[model samples]
Target: MPDRLAPLTEALLAAARKAGAEAADAMAIDGRSVSVDVRGGALEQADRSEGTEIGLRVLIGRRQACVSASDISARTMAEMAERAVAMAREAPEDATIGLAEPADLARAWDLALLDLADPAPEPGAAELQDDARRAEAAALAVSGISQCQAASASYSRQRVFIAATNGFAGGYSRTSRSTSAVAIAGEGLAMERDWAAESRTYQSDLPSAEEIGRLAGERAAERLGARKPKTGAYPVVFDERIASGLVGHLLAAINGSAIVRGSSWLRDAMGAQVLPRGLSIYENPHRPRISSSRPFDAEGLPTAPRDIVRDGTLKSWTLDLGTARKLGLKSTGSAARGASSPPAPSISNIALTQGDHSRAQLIEAMGTGLVVTSMIGAAINPTTGDYSRGASGFWVENGRISHPVNECTLAGNLRDMLMRITPANDARGHLSHVVPSLLVEGLTLAGA
Candidate 1:
């Protein structure tokens, strides 16, 4: 398609300069998506969308403003630039507002090696509907599954281009295929539901829709007849499915934006031990086929592998240009931006070191506690790291699962929880966040 998005970004930059912008950056994204959902073993919904979006950021001295639109006409481009320049003129000055210097821009990349876009033909809506219907049928086949809530299959392809006045220009495309299902067990007031989903860059890599549905059904069946456990201080094992959330909190604490605001628990933890002694967290943006992989950040900076936490110690803050400048540190090339916003720090393709033991082994090691499969809500104190969340899972006694439990609260200090975590070797490799199941000690569980 004659390089559709690049020309749009180039035209946007040209318009910005014509509109009296001292400097500017532009991004254009073109995307198409299709989804099919099935309910009661029949097609319930089918949707498709195709569009192009353009964004412009113009700077006047130290002030900057951003504008975005779905219209790609020349007239809209000019109007967007004019409005952006006018807004910049009225905006408050920020010393950190500026594009990367020419020398700092990514000079080259190997998109072929990344394999982000699958070469295979897109699946048709009819094919997707069949997949969803098969998933629903499989869920219903499970022994104790009362109903299949919904089953879906979807595909998306997006092309993105970024250009700046500082001579940085690049574009890349990505594709994803996904299948998901939700299953319910029991009925009425005693009902319980669970879900399973899988996504991949190449459709060939995705699991069969029937497999996902069966997993969902089995999990929901396992949750039947759940009740509350006794309140006490006990060890807790976070399942691999939800363990990434715990690591995400640590990532957020080290975000330069959070650090700059002095609102993070790890604000003063630089070079200090944050995770357990043998654990480390690594960010690698070049991982092939991973959804978060990118060769360059939003500001045109080249991305590379780095250790966010090494040997349990806090190593580096996630940062973009603005936050790095505010912190008096160098950018980690971790910037991400949407069509309507400016660049901000964000991590991609992070992995926590896995342990030698499996998830079942960790469960055995915990003796008596909870194996938290799912959680809801939170009351976290960001500054102090005090954490409380509603949780549901199976209760363990003498290192064996006794029964399912729900409507309970798990409370602990994140700082301490992370420090004592024991990782299990059960992380899925295809995921962007390769965090394994984690066992934490001395948490207060409130139940009936």
Candidate 2:
């Protein structure tokens, strides 16, 4: 309950200065997690972990090096700083390697407004196991489910603090609770499996285990008679569950790191139309109770809402300090990092504009196509935007789902795909990526 992470970060920064580094930053994270899994109506696995980790990044001249350790002792902090400084001395000079200026650092954030950490006490392993068991029982209760493969419940809490020689210092804590279930339908080679899961910042906000499990069972039963559809060019609807992947590809294309390397398909598309007219991609990092919501980035810079794509045009690239400097642009405050790694450009919460039509309405209008509920592998060409992936879901005919389909491929260029999408107003607001189901036209399907 005491402030454990802040003192560790302060000590780490002090050690870095003592080790003769020109400048440095430190991060300390303390985390605890408990998870329980149930199978065959019995507890199959239970695990718990608690630990504290400290990381130091030291800069000498234009070079920087990072080191991390789980040992929280004063001696280890000093040793980590010394080792980081030594590594920095031998590293290649990069003008972009530096900490944020004091003026640029975030100050006076409202952690309470974010409501990241749940106020309730942590659930015990017995409670988690009970949740898992209930989920499994609910899945087995479904009519067509052959078996409940696995059901799980978990809770995690993490406290993170960041400090730098440039006068940046801030810390926050977050908690997550989740429940999931996997159900199998049919028998032998005809068996199909599917899962349902939900996570929330607060345990009270999480959906009931029975609801998650029943959904999983229903999904598996829906895939019982899957067969490959005929090969041809067809319209495809990426279901709301999997639609985020399509938008994720766009996020990657506009990433500053990819742009700086000139390896992204959209590297030269800053002002070009990337989405259909009237569509936009927006990011917000301060949305209360969302897992990715943060007042400040890993680099201690303030994060704010921004439109990555505005009215169908590429408006901004996701950037951290290093990547922004390399591209002669200002940082987007999108930096994210782990204890053992340097900060890199990353998105927090993003949403694609929802359309007026519902998912059912879109399917009814499609006439004949595939409704892709799940995907397996990818063969994306980052630079050229060529995209292909294994897909499985329902085959639609006469504007109605005819049957389940599997073992098929969907191929198209990402750039072309984005330009031809029709969004459905079915995005779940609770998700970090609030992308609605997207319908794409003229994609080549490889199947029977």
Q: Rate the local accuracy (lDDT) of all candidates.
A: 0.94, 0.94
**lDDT of model 1 at position 81:** 98
Per-residue CA lDDT of candidate 2, range 336-396, in tens?
9988899999999999999999999999999999999999999999999999999999999
What 10-residue stretch in candidate 2 is worst by lDDT?
A: 1-10
Instruction: Report the Cα RMSD per candidate.
Output: 0.8, 0.8
Per-residue lDDT tens digits of candidate 1, residues 9-122?
Answer: 999999999999999999999999999999987789999999999999999999999999999999999999999999999999999988998988999999998889999998
**Model 2 Cα shift for residue 334 (angstroms):** 0.6
Which residue pairs does candidate 1 place in steric collision? none
Give the range of the ten consecutive residues with the poorest summed lDDT in model 1.
1-10
What's model 2's TM-score?
A: 0.99
The reply for model 2, stretches above 4 Å from the true place, is none
